[model samples]
Target: MILNNPSRKEIKNVLDHAKTIAVIGLSPNPSRTSYIVSESMQRAGYRIIPVNPRADTVLGEKSYASLSDIPEKVDIVNVFRRSEFLEGIADEFIKIDCPVFWTQLNVVDENVFNRLADVGYTVIMDRCIKVEHAILK
Candidate 1:
């Protein structure tokens, strides 16, 4: 598991301050966890950028194929992909330079956590943003 996961204070701070999030691996299917989480964040007033190679739009927002394709800066990059793909996503995140990297529940990648945190990113792994939001709010 990714160590040094964000504390309650850090997670709360992130939710309080973050205005926009790029949700990687977001799905068009409403039943999917990615879609539900993105929707919840949107409801909470965060500008949700749905990023999926196969989708043009999700939850009424225009989606991008990748983070690099996004036109504006994102405060957070919430990932829903498997752990095996995280390093590649981390490589992409390095280019985007978003301050926060959030890997959803059950997704954990220690290498990504170390590398991203080393570069000053606030990384959260094996956590669901929606669940946290519900608790912290």
Candidate 2:
């Protein structure tokens, strides 16, 4: 079966209860969309954990090489990677304790979505977390 994004209310609930967000593929460059959006989220009171192998840090938080490298608990696994990378990222995501898997705007993969959704994961795709937070919160 195909997958669909959760309702706005459900998405809002996830954001409402979430605190720490691990941003995969987040760039250290401030001009990058990943960096810009993440910085905004950080300023909005959410803890931003950068998961970029190339960056030492982003938004002043230590950057992990991968999601599994993060030591602390993460409420959301927000991905800024392209569509082709979602499957690989999803593979790593299930191994961690995070509950929500969010893909930035224009990023979506039906196969990845179905696989994660089949296992009862909360998956949000093709939507910007920062945009959702601004509209819902």
Candidate 3:
């Protein structure tokens, strides 16, 4: 199946309408891109759910051990894990039914992309949400 990757316009719409973002694999280190990006989104008034088993908290919010652990609905699932581990994350993502499944820059898996697309998810691979948000907002 040909996956419908979000166009720039579609991405903009998604970013514009999204209220909460679940950042999978968010690191506690302030220098990490995930940390910085999530912080920026939070400052912009988007609720950021930091998902990282190793981290207890980030950006002053309690970190969820996994996507399944998040209590509230997540509009976007921004993945920070490597390509090798994406399938597992995708598995978790499918169970939760997030509208957006975004794989961070340089992370891609064709099989997972196909799977997510088949399920009607708007998948964005190898794109930085922070950069997109800066440009779109």
- 4-96, model 3: which lDDT tens digit per residue? 568889999999899999999888899998889889989988999999988898988999899999989999999988999998999889889
Better-scoring candidate (lDDT), 2 or 3? 2
Candidate with the larger TM-score of 1 and 3: 1
TM-score of each: 0.96, 0.97, 0.94
Q: Pairs clashing in candidate 2? A: none
lDDT of 1 by residue, 22-117 (tens): 999999999998998889989999999999989989999999999999999899999999999999999998898589999999899888899989
Kindly indicate the candidate among 2 and 3 with the higher TM-score: 2
Lowest lDDT 10-mer window, candidate 1? 1-10
Positional deviation of residue 47's Cα in model 3 after best superposition, in angstroms: 0.6
Judging by lDDT against the true structure, name the best candidate.
2
Roughly what TM-score does model 1 have, to 2 decimal places? 0.96
List per-prediction Cα lDDT, in the order shown.
0.92, 0.93, 0.89
lDDT of 3 at 57: 89
Instruction: Go through the candidates in order and give the C-alpha RMSD of each one to the true structure.
Output: 1.0, 1.3, 1.9
| lDDT of model 3 at position 99 | 89
Regions of candidate 1 where Cα sits further than 4 Å from its true position: none
lDDT for model 2 comes to 0.93
